[model samples]
Target: MHKINVHLLGHMSQCETQESSHDSKSKDFRQSDSYSVNETNHTKAPISSTGGTNNKTVPQTSEQETEKRIIRRSPWIDTSSSESNSIHHVVPIKTSDTCPKENTEESIIADLPLPDLPPEPPTELSDSFKELPPINYGQSNSSLGGIGDCNAYNAINSKKRSLEDNETEIKVSRDTWNTKNMRSLEPPRSKKRIHLIAAVKAVKSIKPIRTTLRYDEAITYNKDIKEKEKYIEAYHKEVNQLLKMKTWDTDKYYDRKEIDPKRVINSMFIFNRKRDGTHKARFVARGDIQHPDTYDSGMQSNTVHHYALMTSLSLALDNNYYITQLDISSAYLYADIKEELYIRPPPHLGMNDKLIRLKKSLYGLKQSGANWYETIKSYLIKQCGMEEVRGWSCVFKNSQVTICLFVDDMVLFSKNLNSNKRIIDKLKMQYDTKIINLGESDEEIQYDILGLEIKYQRGKYMKLGMENSLTEKIPKLNVPLNPKGRKLSAPGQPGLYIDQQELELEEDDYKMKVHEMQKLIGLASYVGYKFRFDLLYYINTLAQHILFPSKQVLDMTYELIQFIWNTRDKQLIWHKSKPVKPTNKLVVISDASYGNQPYYKSQIGNIYLLNGKVIGGKSTKASLTCTSTTEAEIHAISESVPLLNNLSYLIQELDKKPITKGLLTDSKSTISIIISNNEEKFRNRFFGTKAMRLRDEVSGNHLHVCYIETKKNIADVMTKPLPIKTFKLLTNKWIH
Candidate 1:
């Protein structure tokens, strides 16, 4: 008998040891009990003996007994007879020989059939379970049962297929997730909305009149051979005109190398378009580059003051004087040049290689205006037998005609048409002059001069307006409404104000808007100074933000343009309803709005009225910050003294009698300060020098400071924004 020992193996241990023992003791265990254990659990099976063995019962050998004892000792195998009906019950087989030589362990094990086990219950998979990627189990090193190995290989292959299918599904889902993420990362496209208004169209319609053009630009701007020929002819005509006036010594042409380059002045062309569409060209010297030492102190020239013009207009309206406008042709060329200067010949004149020596004053010499002033002044005083006014060199008068000269533009006043004609004929004979208006009609005549349209009704009234100027500069608005179907309201008076935050804008956009605003404000300023007294305050306010502008400023400028366009037809009229007073009256209404500017500075507004007709005005921000309204008023009064003196002198000279000059204000405290004799009281205030000046003027009787109610003060329109009703009322009072 052989002793046998059974050892239990864990699940992970290989079955190679069991196979080796089975092969080595194949003969010894031929007649032993037949039972086996699988990798997962124990199973029982019954095996029959070989065919040659006898069916008779034989005595059990020690080996067989040992095997039986081992089987009984194994806890995994069920040996109870009462559990014979169980699926796992092992049935003992009867054999004749204890040790059979004919049969081997492999043959015995191969002959047994595996018991049927219930299929594993379908596994319940969790939601988090993921199928792993397929893994290749190439081969096994264990020498276990062939059937078990084959079955394990097949099961792995089935699981691998399942994992492969799950991996494919995960790849598809991942691609879908990535696609969704990509869409969210993309940017969306949107359309920008455009804002439009009538004022915008009006601004776009303004085309600045070209005053100076280069030779090439002139040719390019004309765009046609006839137009080009016209400019070319005008160029030749200007040169010829200069030659006839003996402006330059044409016979002594000097070589460029022979003259000092610094002494030689460069020349350019100045182009102008007449109302009749005639193009006029003038060859002007670049006198701005000339050194100041090249000329004497006579370079300064003075033109007629605006107050003089106003007085003349008032006198004409009162006395029914014949009025005429004359334009002096080539006035600057008629004078003689003092310094020895040379100029490069203009292009297309066939003298490019030569420089013309200037003999008489050319159009652009540093002293040309003074030379012309001297020549015209001498002509009027010496030749025309007219006496020059005492304080005004540009104004000349005689028993018959009085003339006012503003550069080349001249206005003539006379008691009859013959007297005006006599002066016009003398001017034409001495110098080439154009009679802009002859004053030949007894009813009414319209004259345009210095951007002002004057409509005079004999012995009735004189209406001054800028309808033509506005129309020529800014055309009418014929554009459609906004595309969004929103109708913009008509702009009324200028808004309350603009702040610093609203002026912050992008650099490029701010520059463009500022340029547009400059143009609009320039036109407004011209209108305001000449005729439209209502726009002075608005223009002054808009001028503060020209350098740093935003969308709000631009919109406000557009509104101002719209308002001016709507009131273009309005005018300032001087009526002759009553007989002229024995002596003229010069009245100035001055007001101030304290702490209204962005930096808390004050604004001052001044209106000069001669016999109740507007002559001149000023609206500007004060240079110094004022502490109180009285200080601001004192500053304004001081500033207006010069204007008042000028008006007073002009009126006295024109009427040949003493005139009264009065300054009206809405601040009673300011009037009291002006009339106060105790100057030390306000010496410590902010109005130091200004207060002193105001006291001196009031004490000397140079300015009469009076107080009026706020509602009655027309200068209120110049210092602050007013309601529509008040604005219109004041506007009508100042400008009829």
Candidate 2:
């Protein structure tokens, strides 16, 4: 006879039943065993004999009895008590007598919550039972209360069906259930629960979305992150640069106990993308902290490299020199800070909590730019044998090269190529420069300076235009005015009401609205100056009402901006040619609209031309009122002579020789008074005095005034509003 041995864990309790050999008045042997355990628990099934009585009895075929059983474990009972944690005895499942049961009770344990077991049997299991199948009673969902008709039972019943199909049926024990097949046995109501399987599959099959974040503060669901190392590298680079310049010291402990938190300047990273798709990281010192004078008392940054005198430089060195541009990097970081300043160490730099004592000037400090300018200017004068031009401190000249800087961007002009190289090398030795137009010939160099494109075209014309990148962001218009090709209609009102300042929105909305209006007008004004001269009068007329802008003013501004966008592709030609009339002089045109504004003030329009090319112009409201067109024109001339007289000085400045300039206007009376010292003709007291200064500027300087036909006066475009045909006729030749 063969005896089968079984092992059970201490945490388990079992009541086993076995059949006696005689059924033959077959008797059942029953034993109840209980044990307590602290660790994981296990259980084993009733063993049958291999002798004649070892016959694998079929459960349903037996007339004696068939009992179906199941085990229910309560997972949420008090774990602190061993009695509560112990496994309860198996409970017989109540089913109809007609229901079939398994001869072996293996299916009963299929849904029990069993602890995990190792692949290799433990020491508690004897080698005698090595080939036996593992008694794995895995945990199933408790949602199926007592596992009456759930998927676990359905799977078990399916196994029984497969076994019953064979002639000599052998029960197959499977520990797992196929959810899809298990759900097939369910009624329609249970169908909704099966959607969980499909939902899981759907989720796993689909991929996550990738998003580009602004500053990492607003992303909801993103699968990718930007390269974090780039930001870290930028921060480290800045910190190292500052350290090398002795901008701070953390080696010795400073007294931070008495330091006021408000006195410490906060610093942050300003990330920028350049035109070439590279990154720029600047550490800015927040001077807005502390007082208005803090970090702002030293030097004035408003004295940035002079740009107004550029035309003089252009006229002096147009044909004689190679136009080159370069930018000095870290220009502000080179100078020393006058006052002892403390800054909170930027977190990205990975510095400790200790405050940083700044020794050198840093970016974002109000006076840093001015300090750097002084340092560079001193270096140029002392080391490079360069003379500083008092008119424009940014302009520096050596024996052969002339350099003009606006902030950090330096434009160099040298007649000799070797002289340029020498000057550039000298600058490079003293400062790090990004050579934008390095040894390139002026004819091939199209450099952008101060939003203006200074380019030599085809080795013939020195063209000054606008930077395309600067204006591309403005709103584009399909039509100059209304989209339907109709002229813009006014908003029922003229100007803003005087007391309208009292009307306000929420603080943020008001600021945003104002900024929107300002940005629209500001950029539109620039775009007009670049190529859209038609927008000049409108923008000028609209800008006056920006402070208390009404809906009407905004409506007009939008119309003008739309017009500018419509003609965005146009540009006035800036070229120098021997005058068609043999006059190596300027052509000045001044016009005015008398008492045209809502305040009854006159508008002055002035245009300056050199060698027949429009160099500069203005369309502005006159500071004082004018009674007549003559007075307005005369005042406009007075306002304009300062700028034109400066041009005369520029001409004489070029070669130390007298150069003549011409002024053209339709106001013959105003022109007559300006060219003469005749006080009798000056009707207005204000304009009379202005005319005397105008006469002195015309004669004292070599500027000449002449009268041109109104149709021929291009400056008429600046004076007042005109029809499209008249505007085109007057401005088409000079602009666009």
Candidate that scores best on TM-score: 1
Off by over 4 Å in 1: 1-210, 224-226, 476-495, 502-513, 577-581, 678-689, 702-704
TM-scores of all predicted structures: 0.67, 0.62
Over the full model, what C-alpha lDDT does candidate 1 score relative to the true structure?
A: 0.58
Clashing pairs in 2: 23-26
- Identify the candidate with maximal lDDT: 1
Backbone Cα, N, C clashes tallied per candidate = 0, 1
* Residue 121 of model 1, lDDT score: 32
Go through the candidates in order and give each one's C-alpha lDDT.
0.58, 0.48
| Alpha carbon deviation, residue 311, candidate 2 (Å) | 1.0
Residue 276 shift from truth in candidate 1, angstroms: 4.0
